[model samples]
Target chain A: MRAALYQAAGDVTVGDVPDAALAEPTDAVVRVLRSCICGSDLWSYRGVINRPAGSRLGHEFIGVVEEIGAAVTTLRAGDLVVAPFQWSDNTCPACRDGVQTRCDNGGTFGAPGTDGGQGEAVRVPQADGTLVVVPGGPDGVDEKLYPALLALSDVAGTGLHGAVLAGVAEGATVAVIGDGAVGLCAVLGARQVLGAERVVLMSRHDDRAALGRAFGATDVVAERGEAGIEAVRELTGGRGVRHVVEAVGTPEAWDMALGMARVGGTIGAVGVPHTTPQLGLFPPFRQHLTISLGVAPVRRYLPDLIDRVLAGSLDPGPVFDLELPLEQVADGYAAMSERRSIKTMLAG
Target chain B: MRAALYQAAGDVTVGDVPDAALAEPTDAVVRVLRSCICGSDLWSYRGVINRPAGSRLGHEFIGVVEEIGAAVTTLRAGDLVVAPFQWSDNTCPACRDGVQTRCDNGGTFGAPGTDGGQGEAVRVPQADGTLVVVPGGPDGVDEKLYPALLALSDVAGTGLHGAVLAGVAEGATVAVIGDGAVGLCAVLGARQVLGAERVVLMSRHDDRAALGRAFGATDVVAERGEAGIEAVRELTGGRGVRHVVEAVGTPEAWDMALGMARVGGTIGAVGVPHTTPQLGLFPPFRQHLTISLGVAPVRRYLPDLIDRVLAGSLDPGPVFDLELPLEQVADGYAAMSERRSIKTMLAG
Candidate 1:
């Protein structure tokens, strides 16, 4: 089977690799139908996160089940599904509480030693919780929306979870601090599920700026850092956003998220917070900011999002401006890395 | 009128002073019935909070409304009440949100012009929100609980709020990071309101230990730093306490609060967080902590607490082990300063 294998800088080769088998009784093998690039993928591309040679390189996908292990009872041969970025047993206390990303035995797809979802086929662990049965009973699944549904694997779920963590309540004014695909989706989430009165998107690129606005961003700020904060504050009547979704996983974004919250408001962070908060008061107590960080536990968010998309009220597909064939995987990476597209859809 | 004024280090003295008059329509002249020494009061005694010469010293008190301004409607002459350390308008959105400490207006107490509740004939501002009407119809009040009610002005409310902020669930094990009267009262709050299964009090002084146990602390850890953390983790099945009330206002106490919380638990901080949190990854991403800080908006927690006291369901007075005449406040401060008393109640 051919897969997107990380070889070197500016080097990814789509070629034959050893086919994956059900390595665990709880696993299910899926034939990849659509995969997508995520913001976190750029971490290794920029060498901020080192990738060992020949590492499997994707975590976002929607595909058809090709095989099922003995213990996998829910999913069977030729079943279509959308898999979340992280795999969980669906039985841990945290997973049961809808925070599967913090599952006691949580595991992520892609990266070294993990099966990458962006390939001819991939293996899923704990198939019951990792894969959600697609609407239309699999056969009615729309290919155009496949990129958007596959996005639920990580970016979209993370964006929506960011909204949830930020406490984006009905009529809340939300500012998403990052204009990546996830950030734009956070705007959609702030508006769609949380019923935010206003969604503000902080952006540096025109490509994301358009999608951010389309995804319910009532305001867009092109500036970064303090200027961006000021823009959000101005948009929010100088009190700052009532809720802020921190989608960018950087110190500056973290600080901006803190600044863009109203006093006593919350900053629901789903940016894969790598930087640990300090031991003392990280920000002065006045930000009255409550930061709910870590991965969004996309499994907790997938079910509701699928319902929204199937209902035809939301169209997250607007984020995928540059779709490409799975064979053109390198172009998709370069496009996202260069900010030419908010995301790229990989169709097999 | 005379008042105990904080002059300089070792310079606090009871002296004659100009009469305090109504400064605002919302203000009232309170003939203080009782006052007390607080752990925060020691900051000035230790030359920490450089208070200006002759500034009214005390912040904790229960008092009688001797004179109410025309605009003060809820409180009247002869009405006995507990004055919270901070003044809030009660009508602001922030106050309505149950965080009166961060009230849109009517801010901090005991700063320069801010009237201290400690002295005789002190001015009380924002009476509607700052004062909790003492029950018993303000007639034949239970003088025995006056000290405990006075402590509620700051200490007890602070501890309760700390526990509440730390997100202590009913029936969970609770660990308090300080052993002052506030920390002890937090044990009461946790046990009575939150139904804590275990109340662990961290105390270094024997005088505080006995009082802590009397106030429902099921266990006491005499150690202070890293070893103290180990003790708490050990007691909590090596996972850390389910909830931690940080009642000590120092970096050490703050660190202990972070160290003592289980992953995904809360740390309710009402201990005057003058410093930033520094626990890094634990606070931000890994520990999955929810940190709520601020002066306890006792106004929000008061009605229920006042009821508990009146109904004899809770006796917070056990925390005050010594009583001193107003003239001997110096000795009260000295007694607490020397660890000779758990807490000192001063008559007005």
Candidate 2:
């Protein structure tokens, strides 16, 4: 099987690897149809997050089931499905409560000893609980819908999870920190799912800013730090926003998001933090702030987001600004790593 | 007039002081009928929180309005009232959002230049907004209700705020991480206001533990640190509780509370943090925990709490296990500081 493997910092290779196959009774093998580069993937590329040599890469993908374990009941061979970044047993208390990412016996796609998503084929654990069969069958689904359907695996669902965790409600004034794909999608979720009356996006790039506006951002703040907070406050009529989504996993973004939120407001953070940001207890205490921090339980939001995508009202497919063949997997990672693309979709 | 003033570390004096008078047009002077010692008050008494010489003390009181400035409306001179620990102009955006403690122009009771609640007469800013009028007139409100009414100014209201922020809903298993008056009251709030199905109080003291059970704590955990967490986990069938109220501001309590909460659960923090606790971004992010940290906006919950008190359904009076004359305010502080009493009520 051809798969993406990490070699060293700033280096990746698409080469022959052992084929993925059902290992556990709860596992299934998926033939990769589409996979993409995520912001977190850049962590290892930059050596900020160490990746061992020959490690399987990628955590987001949509594909067709090539084989199912005997124990798998819900999914069968040739079923089109979207896989959340993390696998969970649906019967766990946490999974039942819609926090599949924290499933008691769950694990991530690229964790040590597990098959990764960015491959020709990958073995999925707890296949019956982890894979969501797309409404349409594997046959004749619109090719144009790939990017949008693929987004349900992580990006779109993650953004919506931020909105939900922040308790974004009707007529809320929201500020979305970070203008990455997930941040832009959060702006969309704020407007569509949470009914936010206003969404301010923090962005310095012209292309991303334009994309943010198209995704329903009412205002854009290019300034960083205090100036950015002031800009958000200005847009919110001198009071900060009621809800904020922190999508960039940086200390600066976290601080700015906290400052951008109004007194008593909530900051829903979905960024996978690479740095240990210390939240000083005093300021947030005085402001009565709620910092809802964590990884997005994409599976919890997959059902609703899939419906929204299939309904044609949501076109988050634009997040994929670059596309390449599976053999050019290294190029896909480089494009996203160097900021040459918002996201790169890999066709198998 | 006489007032309780901090003379030095571990030293409080009941001495002559200038009478509280309505200076601002929005101010009202109230004759404090009942005042009580709070857990936070011990910080200064134990020299944990610095206090300037002759600084006025206390922030919880129920009183009778003696005089009102021309701009004061809604509150009359003879009205009986409960004053939240902070004063606010209710018209501010934060106050309108039901977070009065963070009102744009609000101030805490004992802040420099503000009249403290421990005095015989206290000048209250934003009288109409900060003071909740007790339903019955000043003439004949029952003496037995004074302690409960006094509880509303801070203790009971603050506990309820914790429960509310934690989003303790029906069928929730809640764990409160303290044995102080506020924590006991939090147990009550979890059962009464939040409708939590099970309430657990972390207490090592038999007396406090008994009071906790009376306040509706279904279970008690005397262990601290890992053992305490294991106890809670055991009670919840190894999943941890859905709602946690942190009434102790120490970092250890914070960590334990975080550990005790299930994934997707909330930890409502109401304690005045004596130490600057470092909440490292990673643990909370991975756990998907929501840390709702802040001082309780007691004013926001005053009306409903007062109503519950007046209706004879809620009695937080039991927390005040000792009573002292106003002249012995110093003694009341000493008793609570020495743990001789759960809380001490100061009577006029």
Candidate 3:
């Protein structure tokens, strides 16, 4: 099988890897149909975060079960399924509490020994708990919806997690502090699923801003830093938004999220923070702020998000501005790293 | 009239000051019946936080209404009432949202021109919203309950706010990180009001720990630092508590609170942090932690706490281990500053 591997700093390549197979009684072999690059992947590509040379790289995928072990009861061979970014044994205390990302026996797909999603096949552990079968098998669904279904594996579900953590209640006014795929999805989730009355997207790029508008952002602010905060305040009648989704983890983005929240408001941060080391507590403490942040427990949100996508209410596929065959996986990484594409989707 | 004044660092005195009088249409003059020293007061007394010399001291009291301005519709002369530490109009958006501490026109009792609760008489602003009337007048209630009722002004209410923010629920396990009046009250609130299945108190002082146990702490860990965190984890079968109340705000205390929480847990902090400058975000961010903190909106919880006190379901008066007459106000401050008393109550 061929898979994407991290060769070194500023380097990624498609290379032959050992074939994936059912390695345990609870494992299933998945032949990936679609996969994409995440903003977090840029961390390793830019040499900002260290990754072991020749390690497998990606964590999002929608695929068909090629083989199932004896213990896999919920899924069988040839079934279409989506794998959450992290695999969890859903019955653990953490998983039962809706924080599957912290499940006792859970691990992300791209770890050193694990099978990466950006590959020909993946050996999924805890198959019964980790895979959510698409309502219709591969042949029953439209090929055009594959990209959106693949999104359910990570980005869309992550955005919904941010909205849920932010306490985006009915009639809330929210500010999304990033215009990436996840940020646009947050805008959609806050307005469509959470019933937020208004959503403001902070984006300087016209292309991303346009997508955010289509995803339900009622207002857009192109300013950054202090001016961005001021713009968000102005949009909210000077009271600031009651809920803020921090989809960009930069220090400036974090500061903007803090400044744009009203007193007693909440901030939900889903971005994988790479640059920020310490966050001052005094400011948020004095303002009575509630900050809930972490890696999104995407598996917990997969079922509902899949239903929404299959029902045609959500169209997140457009986020994949560039698509390439598995042989050209290196180009997919380059496009996203150079900012030429909002996201890159690879077909296997 | 005599009132407690901050003469300088480590110095507090009772001296003659201007007589209390109604200054605004919403104001009311109250004859102080009971006022107590708070843990936060030590911040200024120790010079950890600067305060202007000769400023009024104290912000928690229960009193008898002496006079009311023309527009004071909800209060009357001779009515017994308890004033929250901060006065708020209650009609503002913040107040309506149950965050009276951030009310548009709210101000603390000890601010320069305002009357301090430690004085013989206090001119309270926003009378209708700042003061919650006791069902019975001063003479109609027992003098023995004065101290308990006074606790509702700040500590007890603040503790309840912590429990609420931590999302304490039926069958939940809670850990309280301080054993001062507020921490003790948090133990009581978590077990009594929030119905937690287990309550753990982290305290080194035997006296405070005993009170904590009486207040419904199922377990007491007298260890400090890493030992304290270890003890708490062991108490919860090594999973840590789902809810933590950070009643002490030093960096060490914050670290203990963070260490004592289970993954995906919440920490509700009510302590007035004086030494901690910044908190490392990576630790909590990776742990999927939610932190909600601020000065308590005591007014929001006053009514319910008062009901609990009046019904004999709560007895926080014991926290006031030292009591003195109005003439001995300086002695009261000295006792609390020297840690000879958990709290001090002053009589008019």
Top-scoring candidate (TM-score): 3
Tens-digit per-residue lDDT, A1-348, candidate 2: 998898998998988888998889999999989998888888899898888999988889999999998899999898889999999988898889888988878999977898888889989999988999888867857878999988878888888888877779899888898889899889888988778898888999999999889888888889999999998888878878889999988889988988888888899999878888887787888788998988888888777777787788887888899999988989988888889999989889
Candidate 3: clashing pairs of residues: none
User: Candidate 2 falls in which docking quality class?
Assistant: high
Query: Who wins the lDDT comparison?
Result: 3
Candidate 1 lDDT for residue B11: 66
* lDDT score of residue B276 within candidate 1: 51
Model 2 / residue B13 / CA error / Å: 1.7
Q: Regarding DockQ, does 2 or 3 come out ahead?
A: 2
Candidate 3 CAPRI grade: medium
Better of 1 and 3 by TM-score: 3
TM-score of chain A of each: 0.95, 0.98, 0.98
Cα misplacement distance, residue A17 of candidate 1 (Å): 1.7
Write one digit per residue (lDDT tens) for candidate 1, span A1-348: 888888777677787878978998999998888888777777777677778888888888888888998998888787878888878988886777566877777788885677887788888888877888876756787666676677777777778888987778888888888888788889988898779998888887776788787788888899888998888888877878768887876778877877778777777776665554343453536555566666777887777888877777666777787888888899988988887777888888
Worst 10 residues of 1 chain A by lDDT: A275-284
Give the C-alpha miss distance for residue A48 in model 2, angstroms.
1.7
